[model samples]
Target: MSDSGPSTPPSPDEKPAKVQFNDNFAGKLILPTEEEIQNDPYRRRASSRRVSRRMSKALAIADILEQERQYVIGDIIDLDTIVEADDIEEATTRTRRFSSVVAASRKSQASTKDWRELEEAGDESSGEDEDYLIEWEGPEDPKNPYNWSKLYRFFCLFTVSMQGFCVAFYSSSYTAGIPGMMAEFGITNRTITVLGVSAYLFGMGVAPLILAPLSEMYGRRIVYIIGMASFTIFIIPACVAKNIQTIIIIRFLGAVSGSVGISNAPGTIADIYQSADERSKAFAVFAITAMNGPPLGTIIGGVLFRYLGWRSINYFSLIAAGIFFVAGFFVAETYGPHILREKARHRRLTTGDDKYFSRFDFPPATSLATLLRRNFKRPLKMLFTEAICLAWALYLSVIYALLYMSFIAYPVVFMGLRGWEPQIAGLGFVGILIGTSAGVATDPLSRWGVRRHKVDPETGKIPPEALIWFACVGAVLASIGLWIFAWTCDPGIVKPWVFCILAGIPYGLGTTVVFTNGWNYLLSSYSIYAASAMAGNAISRSFLGGILPLFAPKMYSNLSPAIASTILATLATALMPIPFIFYFWGKHFRERSPMLLALAAQSGI
Candidate 1:
């Protein structure tokens, strides 16, 4: 780093010379200006993922390079000699690399004017019209979502959790009022009544493909606002629907709008929590509601149906939607680009400087199309081609579908065979609720177990495999729980109905842990592309959840109840080895993907 001894340092009045910006250097904390992203085709629409979404995992690696033990303080980087590094280790290597740039950046940051100070002097009269990069003043910058007050962040998470729960709850709760609706519509066919649930699931699956890109374009809060508003407007039609067609169609539309919570919450959670470990605990709350919402909604819906009618479910949804609708307004924008744009806009207005620009803006025509295509294609590509994706998709699909199928199976066992009241039959899923809660309660322990693994040398944090242990254990627990429910729920067996009901505990716990860790594993592995992978999985899971339940009635009617339950337990068992397969080979598989290596290289260090 040293050349020609006895060199004099540049004076404060002499501005630093401009160097060419590297669009591919996404791993660096320092980003290119909004103009750079917009003008360069390669950088447009890519910063949100490469810069913001990938921040937490990227920082874990970046911070390792900054440690005092790794570098000498006197080193200075000459940008002209720096070559673009293709991987994290090379990018991070202490000998004349991006790490040197990082050390030099830290050294010079204290001497420069922050974005705010620069903004104040941004008047056109003050100097030449030169574009300046707008960014968080520092790691603790209040403008950054990660630096938000803990209590307020939790509030946002709570709002997000409700969005997920209410949508999921409504989808399942519709099943509770099927009998009453069928009677009023003069419909005797059970298959016809199931259509409403299928339509809603369809909406849930399809909506996210569109919403994911919209969130990027507008920010999380705008999506939340639009979704909640649409949900509220649609609930009235659902409540007033005169026939099955009206109910089915309205519920589908409702699900499309309400899906904001289910599809987009994880990104927001990542935005707020910089540490993967912290995200685990936060996601646990999300997992509890998303996984258990169906059963809880059914319990409440059954009670409402017994007293008021099936129409009350929509009314109930309306009330919940109304409350969250208002709450949505209070939720801050969490998307990194959107927030930076707003800051840039503010600085422009205050200082009347055209040069004040957010580093994440995109040119509307080309960038939007490219982003949309990426949002649509990459996940499917990974799903079909990537081994890690294929296994998790199958395992998650079975576990997810089982939740929906339970809406039908519970009724057949508790009402058709046991003769329990429709209202009372809803209580069967209590074990599911218990299990889901238990999983959340034990998430810390699960994360702790994962963190016990050797830290990754590059990222300086636990690897994606940290989530696999619980998923493996959860797979077994889920299968066992299903087998117990299958045998114990049969009237010919000596086991009590309570035992079948209690079986949900293991299933619920298994489900919560499996799902929570499953997502975390993806997040850990893919980093930026995690959203694309997750959105694709949501579609498949929703399709199965909706379609599989259509056969529940026939399954119970044709086969013995125990046998039907055993079939489900068997599916769970088949997938039991999936987590184990992943735990061992996940890293290897992840390593093979060129994009993953790029992500690790760019974000790791």
Candidate 2:
């Protein structure tokens, strides 16, 4: 043998010779022949070592690819092919290329996942480091206002509604103190004193054109707090005012600040409740509180003015503002974009990442001036351009004007004709309160109608027109109530109790249904633009509220109470067709308008 001369053991690094089996040896192992071992002793060892190294390298690459898949794809990986693969280099190359393709596909698809995975994959492909965006962790994320616990949501609703009630209460409550104000100031003209009310209502209408957009930009919480705080603080000047002009000016400013809650409350409710069905009930409660506030405030002001003083009304307002101010602290931010922006800011601060942002984050239309200009003009544009908005605005404005005129009408009927004191006359509002309560109680029926009308038999989706049914029924009821009130206003024709109890109840009931349903319909029809639509409603109502009362004294004096009342009733009867028209033809009108089409698309209608 070649090595026989040495007859030495193999070095430690060298492999031992292998045993081999004969082709047809019948389960017998055959040692390698001496000639074969001498020919290639280390060949099997070298080949085995090379195969082991190659497999280890392939497994390592598979592990890296699997890790990349997890980071990129955000789901479990399938590893059967890599595990079963036989050719190491081929599997490694194929897997590496395939994983890269899968990653690219995932990036391009951008499936809905948490922000973390999207950020990582985005960074990897671009080969540039980027900060992560902040978003809801998932659809059920509790931080989302829509996903908040029921108790918390109700608390928020209650707080905001209370704010609205306080502001609205302030709007008409002080009318009770007007007589005392005239006596104290020694002024003769009632029109001059009524200017206080007119100015306040005008302020309420105009301020929302600006404030609603600010709420959208900043947040509901900040706007509410600042507005309530200013409203509360301004009550002092009005209470101590020595001159009519001073009181009127202070009241206007207070009204301006207080109007913020009115414009923003619907938006907050929309933010909290995404479904029309869910929102209907919340809006019913909201409508009840808002509808009841003026009458309730009149009741409170009558009692306070009789017992305490004229100034006590302002004091009561201050107390209400304080309560809402403290409660405002607990109110969470409800605007979706504002909430997301805040989340983005928190993420950037914590991660020390500059690229973190929200989809809502943008350059904001070049400048603050442009942003404000667009926002300020939006409500006007919606008011004038959209038929749905115009019809609803006209209907609401007329109804609201009639409602304010009732302030004068009630006094004329109860105090002037029936020779009752101011406090007793204020009791006529009890019928309205009863009607509002009835409306609140009947809201479930409206919701049922909405469900029945809106739900697709197959898809279970609600159409926007579903909201108009209640409005239609409300128009009929409101018309009947107006006619009853008009024909029955005379004490000679019917007892005061008859109109007060019978007529006022239906009037209140019909008014509540119309307002609540109309508001809900507008909200549904213009989902993202609901705030601007509401602002339009507010402007029309407030404008009518201010202007209508000025003519109340003349209308009742010039035309007999019966004729004046009939005029209002006739107008109401004429407009009764509005809701019905909208119910049948609203969709066609919406289709015709590009603004409505865009809104419908945004709402996925």
Candidate 3:
């Protein structure tokens, strides 16, 4: 049997971990930093090693599975198969991960389970050498999520994808009902009415701080079910809200409950698909749904608001939420740790062996408060302290804020000025959808770029910087599109409307490119800490999304359409070189930043 002992002792200055890495894990291994070789793999699933809020849910699931266990539970993401995907930075923020807090616990292995005991690829991590362990029956085990039938896997994927789509759709669709809301409440202030959307975003931003730990502790399914149910229930109040305050509060509550879909969908995909090819495809589908849902929301909202009034939009989200609430109940528990514990329980019940135990068989050593504090603090710390985190956080916030701002700007341009009906005006956002589709179509080109880029001679993994070229292209495209949209959107001109609307194609495509590539860039660059960086990014974006819309009505009202948009265009143009700057010098900064270090320890490059 291979020795399960940890790698060479840590230097005095570094923190110690009770983890051991195989000299060769499969054919390739990217050795983990001492930090990546952690005591609690559960924490990593939710935070340090993850992407956005729920993006890391997949990684957390896969990363935990990647840990060698005497009791194997479908080892996922071979070191070389860097688990990366989706423009879900907001979908799965770092603040929502359980590890942001508990991951800091480098305590003894008593409370943790199978995660702690692998002696080698062939053995489990053990406190006692004599304790026997159980592993996968083989690669063919039906219990393994990866080995499940394609039809079943697809079913699971569809449900989770719908969940994400619903959450994203809620974002833009809410903007459409503002006019009805203003009329019903007899409010004249655009900023006050827009506060409804802002409130919803704020709930999404804040609720994850608590949900992150709950999902890890309870498993992802419960969170989804409860969240969906709460979301569905909360919308009822808003539907018949007597005052704007009620709509604002209920929307906030609904969003808090609704966030589970965005927060856990990525992990569900990660849990089900371990192959990089399959995972990438899964994320693409997820990304497309999330992106597409937002743009299409305006069209739907327009028709609903025009025909049934603003209440119809919430009714629609509620109905969708209700359907998923029922569906969520049928979904199986996908958290690897939870699954293993169940398997271990079955073994002990049938065989009557007291030693039958999973890694997390015992209760957690850390308290809820500790988990909360850690999860909350680490991501915020990285947001400010880490250069990569701060830059990406600010960049993504601006991008998302600008998109939300468009909700106000588009209506102002198309409806207020052009004398277009709400139904007709809502169609304006379809351009963005078309642009996103165009962006997704470029995957082949991105793949070619990845292949063409210089690879690590040792690991054969494409460097993270290879993703920057597309980002640069996206930045330029986004700026040009925004500029076109701005200049052509003059309120006084009629012929320019077509040109202005057409500009959304480039803007949508450009934003899609930046979000998608930028997300992957962080994944490749910050091997483990990507979760925190992404979490901070989401928080900032939500903050901006909530606040920026308030400025939109005012800015567009006070300034000429071209001038207002040009101010935004200038910002986009200024950011166009960000990717280029990172492409050349990001590595130097990445190497020096304590938070952004690439854990090149895995050999599977």
Candidate 4:
């Protein structure tokens, strides 16, 4: 009382300074602004200011009861904390509003960048050809091949995959037409069959060197459309050819068109997916399309050959080629350097700035010699020097040869031994269909393995070697199929048709692994020359495919089905481990090999 002195009703200047707390705070609160009021050791005073009565009472009891009373900052007993309701309705409302604002801001930012880059990426030049040829910036650039609009890109993907299907189908379907072709051309069965299969392979092998490089120099869409169109046009001659050699020439030319599938399709898929994991899945899809065509075409060909005549096969191909042509018109170009170079051209035109050209742009009036040098040397260089590329190509070639052999041998086996009709014998090829399905069925397991394991820098997430297990399993099945066809092939016991089905297990599955793994490893190691590498591979594989089938009949005649199959199976068994070896060791080999070193030097890797 003496010191307080009736609180000296402070002067106007000294009146209790207003204590400002945060906004939305209420009166009678001990605000931080007023030192005197904040530090005042006064007992609690009642005021008109409202408080949660429950908290106030609890605080009072807590102080008086002195149950080890300890002071605490913040509301020691918050009414909100004690509340029974799960929702902090006010806080939740505020938080949600804040989050919405943040999310919108982020979306706006991303959208701004996405649109800017996409518009910039799409700008292609027409006048100056210098900007038309250059290496792409990278995967992140909107101009990158993988960054294309999904619809346009998917169209290309479908076209590439379907091309593989069409080619594979065409190759096998011609087998069904062998007899008719022979009769019409007045040639021996062996010659017609050889031309039918061999011409297709020859096309497969040779077209790529010319076509793949041309496509690279120009654009993938142009080559694909032109190749398929040319192939379709040639089918007319194949359908109506009056002589055997004319049929052979037409078939070879038609195959040249079709060879684009074998050479370019896998590379096209690689171009579309940026990541290795994605490429593997794409390879699987491509593999399915590539592998599925043989049986599917053979079956359809068998039925069509029986009912519609052999000309229907060529006619069917015309329909497919027509569909591909229409689709190609809409396929967006995905070549990386091409897209970037196009962007540079746009920049130059828009700003009158020639300084924006990328280093990858080709100089004006590049010579055909330079182009040929690039096309011929690049893929062959990759094939010869890169262990990864060479191994995979070899493996794929073996598997392809094996698959084609089945096509050539099955007709002879079932028709000659079990006396089955062409249509019924064609059903024997269904074994390959089954084996292919079985191989594809392993995809889920492969995906799971990739998910379960940590990524390996060497072979990527799913080692290409993992694909080999299926090949080995398939090789064994093929061996059994061969054994069955060769041994029990006589009409007396099990039908020859049964042997075809059984043998297909190995042939189909083996080819699946071979094509898929070869494709995967090629892309993983030589991404720069992926298209050319595949094109070259197609050349090698198709050449093998063509050459091997030409001799199939003779080989079977000389060796007997059992002996021929045994030799083939033994070779497959020996080679089956090759994929596995490369899967694990390929990265090291690629890094250490002189061939790879030379390729890297040439490619400027």
Best by lDDT: 1
Better of 1 and 3 by TM-score: 3
* Per-residue lDDT of model 1, residues 1-605, tens digit only: 00111112347997532223234554354334545656877665453334332332333333332211111110111111111122323432212211112222322432222322332343334342223546688888987988999999999999988988989889889999998998999998888889888889989988988887677667789889999899889989888888889888888899999998887787778678755356656766787787778889989998999889989988998999889889878888877657886887788689975456553444222245655786678777877877777778888988988878888889888888898887898898889888988987886677467646765554333566756688888888888889899888888884478889888999988887788678667644554355566767777888888898888877988898889988988888887888888888877777787666654454442
TM-score, per-candidate, Cα-based: 0.76, 0.73, 0.79, 0.67
Arrange candidates by TM-score, highest first: which order? 3, 1, 2, 4
- The sequence of per-residue lDDT tens digits that candidate 4 reaches over residues 102-133 is 21222233222232232233223322322432
Q: lDDT score of model 2?
A: 0.67
lDDT (Cα atoms) of all candidates against the true structure: 0.69, 0.67, 0.67, 0.57
Instruction: Please state every model's RMSD to the true fold in angstroms.
Output: 11.7, 22.5, 10.5, 25.2
**lDDT of candidate 3 at residue 86, scale 0 to 100:** 24
Clashing residue pairs, candidate 1?
88-601
Which ten-residue region of model 2 has the weakest summed lDDT?
74-83
The parts of candidate 2 lying over 4 Å away from their true place are: 1-131, 137-151, 270-281, 349-352, 364-368, 454-463, 597-605
Indicate whether candidate 1 or candidate 4 has the larger TM-score: 1
